[model samples]
Target chain A: MQHKMLYVLTISFFKSFYRNRVAFFFLLIFPLIFVGVFGIAFQFSDPLNSPIDIGIINNDEGVSNGVVILDPFQGKIVSAIRFSDRFISIIGNATYPNNTTKLFNVQEYNSSNLELAKSDLENRRILALVVIPNDFSIGFLAALRNIFADDPLLQNITKNWEGYPEPTFSTKIFIQGDQTLQQFSIASTALRQITEEFFSLGSSKVKGVTISTESELTTQGLTVFDYIFPGLVIFGILQTLSAITTLAMTDVESGLLRRIKITQASGSTYVASMILSQLILSLLQLPIMFLTGVMFGFPLSSRLWYGFVIAVILMFGITGIGFILAGIAKNSEAAIGLANIISVPMAFLAGSFFIVPNPELKWTAKLLGGNTIRVLDFLPATPAVRLMRTILLGQQSIKNSWFDLTLLSTLSGIYLIAGLMTYSKRHFQSQ
Target chain B: MHKIYSNGIHAVKGLSLEVEQGEVFGLLGPNGAGKTTTMNMMIGLLKPTKGKITIFGKSIMNNGKEIKQKIGVAPQEFSFYSHLTVYENAKLFATLYDVKNCERRIDELFNLFELDEIRHQRSDQLSGGQKRRLNLTLALLHDPDLLILDEPAAGMDPQSRAVLWSSVKSLVRSENKTIVLATHLMEVADKLSDRIVIIDHGKDLVIDAPEELKRKFGHGETIQIHVKGDLASDEFSLIKAKVKEIWPDVKNSNHSLQIHTDDAIDDLSKLLELLKQHDLKQKIADISLRSETLEDVFIKLTGRKLRE
Candidate 1:
């Protein structure tokens, strides 16, 4: 009999919510707008497609050995060349494998305008500044002789060389930028690779070492949108807090709550009906948000069910907080206001937008068998968000997220019990 | 039962009354007279500060859940979900009460209240009269034994009020349900209630049948005379002195005078003779006699009008 009543109540609640136009706007349209706007914004600024701007200062004076040499590969006579100029030319003409997009927007700078280049770097006009020293050719020739000395065949080919200075003067090529900037790191790494390849061509004996990266997840390249998609979905789920809070407060202020109190329906049945209705809403929200995210270039995860599990667990906690707000508020307007005050900060603290720094407050919990607990772990959203990112972006299975799932489930249970107790004490108890 | 709020408001003082089964009991009071507070206490919505209230010979405080199941409340405000349609609202309550054959019960209520045509319309869009009818309809959906209606006819037009009163009467007559109605309207209490408790400042001043109380505290009958022309201050004072000789409670305002009397025929003859001797009959526009009503009884007990 109680189960039948719960079912009827849940259906009634759903009908009441969807029939109101304002509720439709908040439940569906509002979150879709967030996805649409953020999706477009992130796609344009994606680092994988956009080129980094860099400035090159080539100051190398050519080392004129006054000797002509035969190129082994081309079988043509060659004259001494400034390696610095060659390196700068290679960097200025570098293009991505797509052949249409350039790897870097290289801006040329002279010795006299070095300060100007540095100023441009500070203002983010350029990500990095490459300064080729005057002794660049000397450094290249000396390094080539050292490599040939290691290989006897290369030493035989360069033994007849004349008018070349001894391999003793070694110089450094400086790459300068703000270390804090991410673009600066990419720019420096690309420049270093180009420099190494240029020298490898000078001496046939020079060999280069390469490192490769592989992921256990999908082979598809992950973008910023993919990484933050779970957070966005979690944000949509958080909006249910306002809706549930407003619904509960409206019942109280309208005296419908008191009216229901006089009915045969137990308080737990009513509360369960409300939670079940909102849980259905949360379940529906996850798929809509996820599909919307996929349309906007978010990577589709095979482990989508993992995200659903996280949403259901997190909603239990959110619904509990909603009831708490309803208990504190005197009316629907105040309930909405309180919901915003709690949910907005909770979204940020849970890293719904960006990764938050771990809190400094840590203590050993004797109750948990001496396990260290951070202040953030107490918030259900913290674990829910982390678990979602792990599943959706990292493409890990549910087995890898047991700790986060357990923490989320425990916190959600605590909140659900707390919410029920507070609502009962506030609304059901006589004055 | 008594109720004192947490904020130290003595909302309901030592007020007590008994509601017999299958009878319409009325709680009549002026504004802020603790009618709602008293009704809330009876339904276990509030805990009385110092009193005991029982329903069906069981303590309401201790057996709240069991007692509450047998009672239905229609609060002063429109308490149901406004977003739901009339039929849906009825169905919701019926289901909550675990009514057998809820569909048939809901249909019966909708038909009884003439709500069949607008059953699909959202409650918030309902007219004031329609909303009041729907409020009463939802209360009767489960066929509760005791129905508590707080200002059920408040803000309704005369036609809608008559429809509600008839329906309420039918519930007691045909359904054998007890009703506890709280209202400040004296006519509603006089017409519908079998017994009424007139309370003021959280205390009951009188408790009896409406006619019995009127006979006990009423001023019998009143004769009103409307003058055609404005009289001089001296003429008015002379008429007042002449009327006051027989009935000292005569009241006059705006060229009109009212005289309270137990013997209307005798007083009417004396009043006419006094007017004729003074040659004031030519100035008399109209004269009428009316019996004292529950409003008069309430005023006699509280020294204030029911609305005040």
Candidate 2:
């Protein structure tokens, strides 16, 4: 009868909970919306699955040797400069050789209008923009000619020239885009390096040991969506806890708890029913969150089953928190308010919504080990988020996540015990 | 049992009661008169400051679960899951009580409470009378030996109240279940209860069968006469003196007169004769003779109205 009672109440609770429109929105739809918003924002490099778009305003015209030429590409009357077709070829031919996929999806625009490029940048149609000045080719050839010239008079003339220098050209290269966004910064940096290498080709004598770059084939290449997917899952779990807590508080305020107390229903049975119902809810939220993440271009790693287990454990720990809130709050409104007070800030600090950046203070770093621990690490969500992030990103195996698992388990056990103690202490006091 | 708070507030003090099997016992009290406190203690929801409660010869303090299984309590407040339908609420309670036929029990309760038409409606959407019925139905689902209903008919209409009282009476007679009812309505106590306990300030003032109490604390008969005009002091004294001739104690005011005697059958004639001797019959506009009731007994004991 005791166990059957628990099952009966749990089933009833779920039936009642799903009928609630507010619970429906919070537990299911809200996470999907969150996934959609962050998914679109991080579409580029979504695990390096697609080509990135970058804008280049190539205003460069060929440099003239004492002769001026009008170039429509430049849209300005200036020194006729040569175009670096090799540079364009390098960019166009860049590809992920392992996947046989193009690296960049270039969109060309005429120099007659810069607004089109700026609008694309503002609308996020392009990741980064590069603008080359008209005198670029002229300055490059002049510097090369001076470096290899045998005629003393020509060398003297180029050396004495004040308009441009032999070792460096004043053809200004300006790059525009958000430096904070990793995708934009990566493209802009690549463009800058490519431009530097192209100019170095003009001089044969300039030589240095080549430092080749190699991309690491690992889960570290995860996109922002990979990082945020698990956060949303954890946030969804927190919402489940909040919903359960509010319902529990309502039961208390409505005298339902009191009525059940005088009957054959024991406190353990009631608590068991509440926890079981919330656990079931968390399980339901899991696949929905994962499916939404998949639709948002999140990498569906092979270790998703592992993430599912972690999510269920995370739900267990958080539902205990709901019980604590239910015990402390005077009513449902206060329960929700208190839940928000705990979850919102913890979400941000513990990396559910965003990770709190590590402080740069030396003593602070010393106090909290630079990489091992952080101020937010004390929060249970921190380890839970980390565990989920690791499992979802496939960065590490579940076997290696002992610290996170232990911490989350211990926290869950503590909260469940404390919540039961607090709830029973208050629940048994008759009105 | 005694109930003393940490702050030295005594809600119920030295209150003990015994209810016989197959009897409907009414607990009557004014607001804050410790009725709810005593009921809570009896159901093991509260701990008595002193003394203990026993049900079915088992101490509630130690054998709470065993005792609780046999008792069903319908609290004064609306006490059911508002989010669930009436049938769902009944089924939940039935299952918790381990009723063998859960579905049939829910169906029975729904039909008995006249909630069959709206069995699928959420409890919060029900009318006040319907909510009360649902609350009572949930408590009675287990068919426990002892049933404690605290203001069960509260907020109910006349028809619903009548239905609830009749149902309670039939349950006691047919099932031999012991019922402890707490209410403010003296008429309910007068008509429904075999025995009644009137309490005040957490103390039981009196307890006996309803008729026995009426006979012990109540005047056998009361006579009241309404005068047409305000009686002058001399005329009031003359009427009072005439009534005192037969009944030594006469109650007289400026515009009316009252007399409480042991026998209305014998006192009515003497009362009329006294009114004629004073020539107050011409001044008298209305007269009434009434037998004693629960309200009269309550007021006589507490010296205050039941609602006050």
Candidate 3:
């Protein structure tokens, strides 16, 4: 009833939270770590459009006697080799395996360590590993004959020529298995260019690229962690508020709150104070998480202030939820458990940990509105995210997202009422 | 008159008791007695679980807040906020009680309890006796007309308890504060209560003045004596027979015999005269004669010790 009491409770809210160092770190640090690890795991860099910095390792020897070996595919070997890259190093050092020979390096050994070598290739560590065979001229010529026509004798001779100088022998023509675009395409084009230099192969021999033209998905490369940073912080604040509310239940049971009840401080005033405390907590939580992102170079979109407005609304909404939970919870443990049950799911579903499902869960979002517990629709948080994102990123407006915004606002109102009702419904019994 | 109608199970069983503007009434009971339940009913916490509780001829259920405001309750349990300083704790309750100038009252209580030095100390941090006293102080801070205290001094040490007893005596005797006290301590009830109500197993065992309960055990005395003169073997027997005619419960020894009687002093005077007539000089080692007290009356009425 009194505005002054609300202000006082709001101040106390931060005092209790900050006094607990473990709680402080758990609320702030835990979510940042959650985001960081997830961000790293979900990272995917687009090379052409984005900075796709890759490390390369080349272990290739130059071609022997200028002969290009057939690529190691059986019947499709000719085409596979035709499409398959023969390196002229696009990325690696220009130093060849044999100074006298101009062709790019190839693997001479058929060892098992090549798996590690291939792993490095996919991660873009090695652009290509080219191990040239000792009898490379002989092996290259015989392989080319077999690719020219599938002659059994030429294949047999090619197999024999692929062997080591004396008694050792194994498979040939190994390229990196898990290749990145840069590592892969560079190797293929380089091989094709080298072949052209040796055989006067037309541009036709160079296979055309299969570039896709679908509606391109160009994100700023926001990872799961980055997206969920604000979310986890919000979740933490809500959970802590709920936990505190539960603790306050003792005040009722122990007669302290009952005594308070007999005072001029009405139930409405008491409930409002608690709500104010929680909202302040959630608000404080927001800035902490936002700072984390900002420090980590995850810019709060320039429209962050609008996002801030949504955050305040969310804080109020969640504070209401916390009060409701606190009112219903029989004890501290129950309060904590119930709060987690609400917050954890909301965090995950609201895309605190990932992208909130899009176009919203159309029918459900319409039916449930913001009041729905189904965070998947992001009823409240979805529009909230959009609002925050647009603000942080300095977007024009939340034009088409009217439904989301409406649902969020409506859900907030509903929760606020429910929370107040829940708080007022329970009476303090004392002797 | 305080009207209390307890319905379900009838722990108090529709009991109605009253006192004048300023009177101390004691509720006496052993452990597991219905004193607490009765108190709860009076406070309107249990909703009677059945009956009606009235103070000043108004139903507590209807005038609960008004009645609650005028009454200060100190529960049997130590119910102060352990986390709060004594001053803060009192201030908190004062605020809750809607008392303006709560700081003055808190200061007053702290000084009254002699807790001014450590008013800032948490209640749980206090010694058991100090906590007991503070608990009383909190209730008194509101200056309520009706003070209902239950097991108030259960955990207090003797000195602190004496201090508390004196304060209570002053509150009732000097300040004319009406107090309804529930206690297991017979001595405390005897010293402070103008009238006592004893309950057992959810029933009122007895309700009367402490002297009345004591008188129920009725005029009886047993005196012990040590002989200085060696009386002949039959000499002691003659005196024993004389004392036994009046006392059905009698015990004897070579030098003494204890007799239960209506008048111990008269019986003692006759025996001493008989000693002189028989030419024997006897030593009167001890003679104690007094009205029966609460301890004897409680044991006699309940057929068990009061402490139990």
**Candidate maximizing DockQ:** 1
Could you give candidate 2's per-residue lDDT for residues B1-308 as a string of tens digits?
Answer: 99997688899989988989778899988878999888888988788999988898989988987888889888888988778898888888898888888788777767777888999899879999889888888888888899999988788888888887777777677779888989888887888888999988999999999899989998887888777776576776676677677777667765777788788878888777767776678767788987788888888897888898
* TM-score, cand. 3: 0.61
Residue A137 of model 3, lDDT score:
31
Task: For candidate 1, give the lDDT of residue A78.
Answer: 61
What is the TM-score of each candidate's chain B when compared with the real chain B? 0.95, 0.87, 0.79
lDDT by residue (A5-32, candidate 3, tens digit) is: 4454344445545555676666656656
Error of 3 at B66 (Å): 3.2
Kindly provide the TM-score obtained by chain B of candidate 3 when compared with the true chain B: 0.79
Cα-based lDDT for every prediction: 0.79, 0.74, 0.58
Q: Which stretches of candidate 1 lie over 4 Å from their true place?
A: A48-220, A365-372, A395-397, B227-242, B253-255, B281-285
lDDT of 1 by residue, A136-216 (tens): 776666656555546665555555445444655466677876432335545565666677676666545333222111112
fnat, candidate 3?
0.23
List the DockQ of the predictions in order: 0.59, 0.39, 0.14
Pick the winner on DockQ between candidates 1 and 2.
1
Question: Which one wins by lDDT: 2 or 3?
Answer: 2
TM-scores vs. true structure, each candidate = 0.77, 0.70, 0.61
Q: Tens digits of per-residue lDDT for model 1 on B80-177?
A: 88988998888888888888998888888888888999999999999999999898887887788999999988899999999988887887888899
Worst 10 residues of 3 chain A by lDDT: A208-217
CA lDDT, candidate 2, residue B95 = 86
For residue A405, what is the lDDT in candidate 2? 82
